[model samples]
Target: MSLSPDVFTYVADLVQRRAGIQLDAGKEYLVEGRLQPLAKEAGHPRVDAYVRDLRVAERPADVQAVVEALTTNETSFFRDGTPFRLLTEHIVPALRGPNGSLPRLRVWSAACSTGQEPYSIAMTLADCVGPDTSVEIVASDLNTAVLERAAAGEYSRIETNRGLPSSMLVRYFDAEGTGWRVREQLRRQVTFLKHNLLEPPAFGGQFDVVFLRNVLIYFDLPVKRQVLEHVLAAMRPGGFLVLGAAETTIGLDDGWERVPLERGAVYRAVPRVPAWGLPTATSPVPVVLPAARGPLTGAVPRTAPPGVLPHARPAHVPAGVPAPVIRPITPAPVRGETR
Candidate 1:
């Protein structure tokens, strides 16, 4: 059944307020499609009836259920392949620099859906860092239901098949009944929590790298600005920000300095300096060797000129590979190489 105009408006406004997702005029089917199952489970014969009850009054839990229902959670392990590639070949090496001990990375997988993205990140890090990994990952999504699933670290056969390399799958996941489960070693590397992108990240400290892919396209200009601001505040100086292929910070925020990668580009934030040139009371810039200035290392101010990068850029991601079909870019400025 179709959603009544009143029901649609109320749900749309509720979702927008709670998650910053815009459910415009043409998304009635989408709203209905997502909420109908929830309606049935709630014992309402129709979406309209369910929303009517919600309008009269609904608990926080009920509101959350509705918001989660409307939020898009389409994700796959290494969905587009570019972000992970950048992470391994470009971002990781840049952070490691050409010397010193391996640095522990603090990565925030924002808007992580059902664990794939974060799990994929964990696997990638594990592969790069080897047996003695010291990476700390916090994977957050507004939808608690997905967070719960993510924490469990289980995936169905079909889910495992997508974008997951067979070698990594066998190496990282132990077959559990019908679906595969992330091995404890890899699963322990990531912590999942419920988070909202419009607000400050719940984690008090700054992050070395953040994965915020494919989420901003759902938000309007104002909300997008707000989200970027929040991301900027949470990122350490020179920390990389990964956005979806179609998304960008070009006109939205000047704080970010774009760094182009092989297939897609990543942005880095310019850390603010204290007025006295002394370290700020909060998140003081730490003095370190030049090797420590890459994307996922500890925070430090960039002293280089605006056009120059604080860290050395790689020659290219893969030195030599046949040109495959590059993902189409919307002139949104998301496509590029990382070397």
Candidate 2:
């Protein structure tokens, strides 16, 4: 049976209130498709009755489950090829630099579902950045269920085939029956956390790059702007911000400058001071040494000197890779609230 407009609206509002996600009027079929199974499992006579029970119940877990069930977790290894290429070729090398003095590199995969995104990054970094440089990757998602799968760092062979390069599969993963498990060495490089983009990220320091791809499309404009503001604030100057191919920061904020690379689009934080005002003095900058040589030995300093920029080598640009093309910023569309 079709969900009445009134029933759909109530369920939609409840989902939005709890998760800050928008369910459009046209998603009536989606509502019916996702909820009908639950109704049957609960032995409810109809969809309307199930929704009514949800409304009257004081416990919100059932509603939360419904929202999670309806959410789109469509993702795969390197879902978009360009951003990973950019990270491996330009971003990582640029941050690593010639001296290799920096001993740690930090990256965040916001809304990383089922661990594919972050694992893909780990593989890329392990391959291009080499095993010697210290790198730490943080993968977060609002959905605890997905986060748990991500933490496991295992994938079915069919699921692992999406967008994953054959060479990487051999190098970073070990076959387990019909599935693949990320090697312990590669798995150790990443940390999984439950984070809500609507709240402040619990990261200790600014990130060198943030992958907030594909998630903003689900939120209303105001939520998008707020989330972007928070993400930008958490990124270090010169750090890159990657969004989905269809998404752009045009007209959103002037703080970020569009940096077009051969693989795809990425954003960089505008320098705090104008180029002309950069400090010209040749004062010897103190460099801190790494405590020990480990997987990330050359990625960051063991201790940083005050006011010294964290050193990062430019990501390795593959031979024949095109140079980055800088583009002018476009204005973002005005935000609206949808109920």
Candidate 3:
């Protein structure tokens, strides 16, 4: 059943306004394809009639069903090897110390689908910080359906092979029939929660690293900036923000200083006050050794000088071979800002 252009526009506008998801003109097919099944399941005769019923329905469950169906949850294990490589080799070391005195290293996998991304991160952290390090992986998704699968930590063999290296795969996952299961220890390290990035981050305080990768492409410019701003606020100063290869913060917020790793890109927060100007009271006075400043002092700002966005230059690439691949693992809408 075909939906009138008028109905399509109405539904699309409602989705974009409420969910921050942009439905392009060509996505009419997607609306028809996804909603057709839902309409049938709901006992509606046709897509147009189903959409009409959805518009007048008091309960939001049907509306959410359409949104969830339309959402593209395509994700896989260890997607785009470069970022994970950077996370394990550089980002993790900088955030953590040798003794693991800090009880937690908080990492959020924003928009994590079916759990592959966070599990990949968990495997990397386990290897880098040692299995015993007290790291907390918070994986969240807008779709409750995917979150449940992620919490289960189960994966098909084909799904497991994507972006997953053979070596790390053997170390972190065990095979069960046609599926692979992430090790219980690695699985236990992560806590799966439901969250919507379009809403304010409800978890409070800053995180050491926030992974808001490919999900941004679904949003328009304003939503993207708003989401990035909120994600940045949740990230601690000097903490890492990883984006997808095709993505960049260049045109968006200036608060993030893009730090180019040997393999991939990471954005570090620009301190409100430069370290040289920080008051001793608010600083990590005891933690700063003369040697610690050596790295910061010599390091150039990742962003462009003065007015430029951080361009990918050869000089920014660290000298040395790339690190090994780790392994493939395997929210609410609020009208107003809710704390």
Q: Which is the winner by lDDT between candidate 1 and candidate 2? A: 1
- Using TM-score as the measure, what is the rank order of every candidate, best first? 1, 3, 2
Note each model's CA RMSD in angstroms.
12.8, 13.8, 12.1
Give the clash total for candidate 2.
Answer: 30
Model 1, 130-199: lDDT tens digits are 5444799999999999999999999999999999999989999999999999999888889998889989
The CA lDDT at 140 in model 1 is 94
> What does candidate 3's lDDT look like per residue over 101-170, in tens digits?
5456889999998998999998888777754567888888888888998998888888977888889788
Report lDDT (Cα) of residue 61, candidate 2.
Answer: 71
TM-score (all chains, Cα) for each model: 0.81, 0.77, 0.77
lDDT of 2 by residue, 1-339 (tens): 689888899988876765567899999999888888888887997888888888788366787678777777889998878888888778887777568554778899998989999998888887777556678999988788898888888899888888887888888889998899999988898899988788778876478889988888888888787788888777877788988988777777677888867546688866443232222233121122211222233323443233323343225535344432212223345789877
TM-score of 1: 0.81
**Sequence-dependent TM-score of model 3:** 0.77
lDDT for 4 (candidate 3):
90
Number of backbone clashes in candidate 3: 2
Per-model CA lDDT versus the true structure? 0.82, 0.76, 0.76
Please name the candidate that would achieve the greatest lDDT relative to the true structure. 1
